[model samples]
Target: MTEEVNNSAPDNSRRNFIKTTALAAAGFMIVPRHVLGGKGFLAPSDRLQVAGIGVGGKGESDLTGVFSSGKSDIAFLCDVDDRRAANSVKRFPQAKYYKDYREMLDKDAKNIDAVVISTPDHNHAMQAMAAMQLGKHVYVQKPLTHDIYEARALTEAAKKYKVVTQMGNQGASGEGVRKLQDWLDAGLIGKVHTVYCWTNRPVWPQGIQWPATGGNIPPELDWDLWLGSAPYKPYVEKLVPFNWRGWWDYGTGAIGDMGCHLVEPPFRILGLDTPVSVECSVGSVYVDEFKRGYFPESCPPSSHVIMTFEKTNKTKGNLQMHWMDGGIKPERPEELLPNESFGDNGTLFIGTKGKMLCDTYGANPRLLPLTKNASDRTRPKAKRVPGDVEGHYTQWAEAAIAGYGKIELSSPFEIAGPLTETLLIANLAIRGIDVQRPNANGKGVSYPGRDMKLLWDKQNLRVTNFDEVNQFVKREYRQGWSLGV
Candidate 1:
């Protein structure tokens, strides 16, 4: 992170002035992409100039997807860890590499037309917002942001800035989702009332105390930059690269990791909006033989979250969606044969007339009762992405090149924001399970956030009944960093 940021920047005041000037110029001076050729038009030779933040692991694949579209030029690359970034750097040798995103944006905003972000959950909102503020189109990995407030902010920003946007829930563009939509629209499922989505996640550590001892920092890693916007703490072992998902400060736990893929089928088919209420029950860990472990900073190992969304035109009434992770699953649907394989990760939709099930990313969609697969359910009602799930990347890149409103997107921030909020709201309930308060006797502590359903004030972005959980809705960034909204 800091490895590539060693060159000293100008003094704080001058750096701020430069940043302000650069962003202002980038926003106002750059010609709007949509206006060129009067919407949905790009010259054949024109290619999107993309700057990739977090160009490693998922970031690598994401950029590759965009580049493979034959409509993008990978102009710049940024990552906190040099080791993680090596592959991307080698793949696009000409793309300038930087460890600090702010530096790249500040210096190269004019050179970048769009940005592809695949950073950790904690860094997603800030980086995406910075790019959007500079009038750069963005494709961000899902759950769109780490906090509900951040999601709401990014959603609004996408509109205000008038930049083309897409979330990295590639499943949204899959044929299975469109097929499910067609079935639901055709009255096959008959008003989905209850939806169950489950995944075997939290493959990383959770429900554990932070290590008391600090681990030696990797030479190629910059610990401070990796902690962007998060509160300062010494680097610990096995936390970088992937395990950050289990920590509340850096990740959004299992639901955040897989909820977008699993919950998406019912969400899109039913046209869901911000959930009105959410409740969750999480597995507990015992510190010893008696006392249950209370690691407030860590997400629970297992959780069952239920979110209640207001009725949409596609549904008969309000819909109740359940999300389970850490290997916990809902009761098997009775319609299936006992020997049928219930996927390890899948989504099940229960409606008034029947039921439907699909694996992760809405793949292998099938109507329950097993025999329903014999009938022709394929309806070309919903348009399919050219390459299905893999097309998600090119879809965004093309829409970005064609300009906003020129083409439809499967999961723009407008959709991803609320969808992400649903997950984060569930997390509020999960984290609420550990909120400490004085006991009735005023001596020991109690967990008041437990056992109560959290009511959401969607407009206000806060919990109505429980105030303690609201603290998580928006977090203060560490000094010298801002959402830049």
Candidate 2:
């Protein structure tokens, strides 16, 4: 229960007045050529004024799905929990609420434009890198960042604040994950190798029990901005309005709560990058009675993570991916169909030619051994792919007013920041035995230690194993709340 690492020092005159008013609003920004020629387009009487920042539980279902997808207009609502920002200001009575999202981005930086953060995950890379350095346009949710150098510094501040980003792994804009990425890009599962993907999640909050050591800190909640950048613990409603997803200094457990929606459709129809190694095997162990939570009654209220992707002669080969959560379920391949039921949240893949499954969030995905190899007939029917047309909160309100139109955003932080740095490196391999010690599965347990299996040069994000886990790839802020990279 002691994480705290902000290293402060930002606010360089509010970061150069949000970089000179987002470079003078990107020099008069007008690239909305058509999409009804912007200026509040997505029509329902052209809305989109939005500003939300963690507006209570699933940010109040992503602000009622972007104001019922009439395409936005919530105005402002932030939250460090004043009764869940007064229940989103009683369903946005012309909202203007704020409990400090840096004082509602210093008093509505010219009427928000777009924000919607859905916080907690250690204040998601500092409120989506201060709303993409104030040009706004962000959606952010999923395991976007709670380390791994703030998921590559919020994917390079959303490509240097050009903004318009999305992450709330809303089953990657379903339609069964675009027909499971067009059945793994029309190969109908040929290359894939081994991919599993489970999730029962803590089923509705899991087993890592910890919360009983005093109380009294709920005068409507603030507790230091809900323990803002986390660390100075004490106030505890079992760690906030929704048991902070199993907690590892503030959520990222249960493999960062369903590893970006069960490891995003086999990491985007098998394009998986970075993972020449990673190993985890847990179950049985207890007595860390959860501090800043993240199970440890010896470990394994449910666990099994075995990642292994290696194929860098320019990818498209060696893959392994297995990951199972609480109700653990993998090992059902006799070509499936025993009345087929890879349910309770899903993903399967396992191909050389047949298998692929789906569920939990990606809804109905299929493609099992419907028949082909040495056929008894019946396999020719692969077409269905159009999912989330104007869905995932109107695809982030039509990419915040006409930007990413052909609507493809599902966990886009260049792929949810390396799938949240490989599920927060499995919570640093389940707290790498509190940083060295327990190995033969004893203290907290550990693995992936040939110096955390090196190899991740993603261009130059570093770690060919630079002296072992390169200080676990970033973290040491906590002064005025650093995070500038």
The lDDT values for all models are 0.90, 0.68
Clashing pairs in 1: 1-80, 1-222
Model 2 weakest 10-residue run by lDDT? 32-41
Q: Write the per-residue lDDT of candidate 1 for residues 309-331, one digit (tens) a residue.
A: 99998877999999999999899
RMSD of each: 12.6, 22.6
Q: Per-residue error at 385 for model 1, in Å?
A: 0.8
TM-score (C-alpha) between model 1 and the true structure: 0.91
